[model samples]
Target: MIVSHPRRTIISRHEQFHLAQQALRRLDRGTGLIALGASLIVGAIAALIWLQPHLAPVPASIAINLMTIGIGAACLIAGWRRYSFHRQLRAATAITDAPMIDCWIENAFEGEPGVIAWELVTSQPDGTEVRLRQAQLIDPSLVTVFQRAATVPVRYVPANPTVSALIIE
Candidate 1:
C-alpha cells in the first residue's frame, strides 16, 4: 500500500520579514526621535539663557526646564520598557521545528495584572485561514509594546498548533 503525507506548507518570509523589520525599526526610531526632540528643545532654551547677555523670558524658568526633563525621562523609560518587552517575547528557551507565520492581532482585553486576550490570524497556502486564540500575562512594563504593536509573528508546531510563542523579544 502507498500512503501520501500532507506536504508541509512552504511560507516565504522575504517580504514579510523585511516589512516586519521595517515596522519595528520605525517604532524604535519614533521613540528615539520623541525623546531627542524633547531634550533638544530644553537644551536650546537653556543655552540661549546662558549665552545671551539679557535675562531670558519667564518660560525659560528652572521650573519649566525641570518639567521638560521630566517628560523626556518618561519617554525614555517607556521606550526602555518597550524594548525589554519585545526582547522577552522573542526569547525562547529551546529550539523546535515550529513554523513561523505572519499574524495580526484580532482583539485584546485586559484584566487583573493585565491578562491580554488576542486572536492571531494567518492565511494558509491552500486558501484556508487559521485564527489561533492566545492569551498572555501582560505586565505594566510590557503594556507599552503591546499597545503600540499589533502584528505579532508566531511560531507553532504542526502537530500541536495550540501551543505557540511570539516571534519577538
Candidate 2:
C-alpha cells in the first residue's frame, strides 16, 4: 500500500513558525500548566509564611522560600526551552531550502512498537551521496510502505546535506 499524504504548499518562514509554535504550545500545555501551578503554589506559600505567624526562624523561612521559588523558576525555564527548541527546528527548516530526493532505505529495524530506525541514502545530481540514519516513532500503517517502496522521499538542507529525513508532508 502506498503511504501518502496531501501535498503541502510552500509556506513563508514567519507563517510556518507561527503554526509550528502553536502546535508545540498545544503539546506542551500540560507541562506549562504544571510549571505555572508549581510557581503559584510556591508564591502562595512564601506569601503565607511572610504574612502569617510561622514557628520557623526568619532566615530558614527565607531560605525555604528562595529554594522553592528557584525550583519553580527552573521548571518554567525548562518548559520554555523545550518549546523554543521546536520553534528553532521549524525556523531552521523554513529558512533553508532543502531539496527533496528519492532515498533508498539501506536498512530498517524496529525498536519499540511503532518506532523504527531507517538508514537511508540518496544521490545528488552531481553524484554526491547523502545519508540519513535516525530512529523515529512513525505511524504503524506506514511500516509496510517503507518495506516495499524502493525509495522514499527525503529532504536535506544544502548546507548540511548529509543529515536528512523522510519528507514530512
Candidate 3:
C-alpha cells in the first residue's frame, strides 16, 4: 500500500502584506480620482456664480457655493486620508516579519453565498496551540477546496499572535 501526502502551500507575511496593500491602493485610487473630479466641478460652479450678473441674488448664491465648497473640501480630505492609510499599510508590511505555520481546518461553513468561515488551529514554536477563526468572502465552491486541503497556511505576527490571516493561496 502507498499513501501520498498532499503538497503544502506557504506564504510569507511580506507577500501577504504586499498583496493587501496593492488591493487597497487599487480600490482607493479610483475613489480618490473621483473625489478630485468632484472638487473641480465645485470650483467651476463657484466660478460660475461669481461670473453671473451683478443683479443676481448674491446671498443665496454665496450660500450654495459655500456648501458646495464645503462638500468638495470634505471629499478631498477623505481621499487624502485613504491614500495616507494605503501608504501606512505599505510601510507596516515592509517592516513586519511573521512566521508561517501549518494549520488544520477544525470546521468550515458558509454564512452566505461567496463567504466562508474557517476555524483553524496551529502549534507555536514553544508547543503552545493557537486557534484562529476567520470569515472571508470568496467563491462559494472554495468550501470544498478548504475541506480537501490537508493543511492550510497561516501567518501571524509574533508580537500579536491573535492577529492572524488565513492564506488563501
Candidate 4:
C-alpha cells in the first residue's frame, strides 16, 4: 500500500499555527448565526402579537412577519448542530503538532451551500484503522478544493488516532 505525504497543505509549524487560527474563527462564527436566528424568531413572534392588537390587519404585513419567522428558523437549525461541532473542533486541536498523514476522503457531503462534511479513513501499520468524520464551514473559493481532492492532510495523536483533525481551509 502506498501512503501519500501531507506537505502539500501543511508543511511548517508557522503555517500550521495560522491554519489553526482560521479554523477556530470559522468554528466560532456559528454563534453569530445562532444569535441572529433567535432574534429574528423572537422579533417575528412579538410583532405578530403586538401589531395585530394595535393596527388593522394587512395581508402583506402578515406575510412579511411569516417570512422573517421562516428565515429565523432556518438560521437556528443550521447553527444548532454547529455549536456542538465547535466544541469538538476545540478538542481536536491537540493534534496541532502531531505529524500529518494523508487520509482518503472516504465520503463528502455538502449538507448546505458552503458547509462540507467529510469522512476520512486510513490504516495503521499495526493493522488498526483510523476513521474521522468532521463537518466544516468553508469559504466558497475553497469549495472546489475540498470537492476535488481525493485525499487530505490529517493530524492524529500517535497513541490515539481517534483524536484527529483534518486541516481545513
Candidate 5:
C-alpha cells in the first residue's frame, strides 16, 4: 500500500545505537531470567544429590552439572556477540532531518547464515517503509549486520541519492 506523511527529522546514529543497546539489554534481561531458572533447577538437583546420593551415580550427577554449565556459558557468549555486533553497527551511520518509513519484507537471510537487506523506498513526510529485499539470497556476514541494523531506525539523506544512515535508535 502507498503510505505518506510529513517529513520529520531523522533520528541520529547515536540514538539508533542507544536503541539497539536498549534492545540488547532487554535480551540480556530475558537471558538472565533463564539463567535464574536454570540455577534454581540446579539447586534442586544439588539438594537431590545430597538427600539421595545413592539414587544416581556420581558420574551422572557430574554430567548434569557439566551440561548446565555448558549451556549457561554458551548463552553468555551469544549475548556478548550480539552486543558487540550492535556496537559495530552503531558506527555505520549518522543522524539528519530526513523522513523515513517503517515497512517490512520477507526474511532476507532465510537460507543464509546471517545476511539481510531492506529495500529503502523513497522518503516520506512522516516515516519510511523499507521493504525487505531478497530474503532468500543473503550473505552470512551481511545478515549479521542487517539483523542489528534492522533493530535500529534508518533515515535517508538527500545529499547523496542512494545513501542513507542507520539511525542508532
Candidate 6:
C-alpha cells in the first residue's frame, strides 16, 4: 500500500528519544522489582544460615549475590540494546521527506518490508497496533501513543512511495 502524509509534518528526534526513554524506564522499574525480590530471598537464606551455624552461609550468600548481579547486568544490557536501536532509528534521516509505511506481506513472514502509507493512522487502545480502517505495523514508539489515543500521526516516503508507518512528531 502507498503511504502518504501532509507536507508540514515531521518526526522529531526529541520525540523518538522520549519514547525510548519511557520504554527504558518501564524496564528499569521491572528490574528493580526483581532485584528487590532477590534481596529478600538472600536475606531469608542468610537468616536460615544464622539459625544453623554448622551450615555454611558464605557460599550461599555469595551465590545469591552473584545471581542478583547477573540479573542486573542482563537488565542493563537490554536497556542498552533499546537505547542503541532508538539512537539508530533517530539517526535515519531518509524518512523525513516522505510518509513512511511498513507493509507486511502475506508470505515472507520473517523479515518484512514496512510499507508506509501517507494516510493518518488511528491508534487502538492496546497500544500494540495502529488502526487505519486496516491496522498498520508501527514502531514500538508510535504504538505507545496509539495505545492511548484513537488516532496518530504518520509520514509517507516519496522514493518508495508505497510504504508508510507512524512517526513520532
Clashing pairs in 4: none
Q: Where is model 5 more than 4 Å wrong at Cα?
A: 1-57, 94-169
What TM-score against the true fold does each predicted structure earn? 0.34, 0.43, 0.41, 0.46, 0.32, 0.31
Model 2, position 54: C-alpha lDDT score? 58
Please name the candidate that would achieve the greatest TM-score relative to the true structure: 4
Per residue, candidate 5 scores C-alpha lDDT tens digits across 98-168 of 22322222222133232122334444455664432111222334433443232334444433323333443
Model 2: clashing residue pairs? none
Pairs that collide in candidate 3 are none
Candidate 3 overall lDDT versus native: 0.46
- Cα displacement (angstroms), candidate 3, residue 132, comes to 13
lDDT of 1 by residue, 1-169 (tens): 1111111222233433343343343234245745675675678567556844454556556566666666766766666665654454444343332222223221222232322334455556675767764544435355445554434455544333444455546
Write down the worst ten-residue block by lDDT for model 4: 100-109
Per-candidate local distance difference test = 0.45, 0.45, 0.46, 0.55, 0.40, 0.40
Off by over 4 Å in 4: 1-28, 92-119, 122-169
Better of 3 and 6 by TM-score: 3
Those runs of model 2 whose alpha carbons end farther than 4 Å from true positions after fitting are: 1-34, 37-45, 48-63, 94-113, 118-133, 149-166
Model 3 misplaced stretches (Cα beyond 4 Å): 1-27, 30-34, 37-49, 52-57, 94-167
Candidate 5 displacement at residue 24 in angstroms:
11
lDDT of 4 by residue, 1-169 (tens): 2111242242344433333343344545478889999999999899999997676778887899999999999998878766755555456533333222222221122332243343456567788877654333455456556555655566555455544456764
Q: Write the per-residue lDDT of candidate 2 for residues 1-169, one digit (tens) a residue.
A: 2122212233333433343333334345246745684876678576756754755456666666667777777777767766554444444451222322211221222332232233345567788886644333445655545554444454444444433344545
Q: How far out, in Å, is residue 10 in model 3?
A: 28
Tell me which of candidates 2 and 3 scores higher on lDDT. 3
Per-prediction CA RMSD (Å): 16.1, 11.9, 11.3, 11.2, 14.5, 14.6
**Backbone clash tally for model 6?**
33
Candidate 6 per-residue lDDT over residues 112-169, each given as its tens digit: 3222223333333455444222124344334333333433453433332223334555
Model 1 CA lDDT for position 34: 54
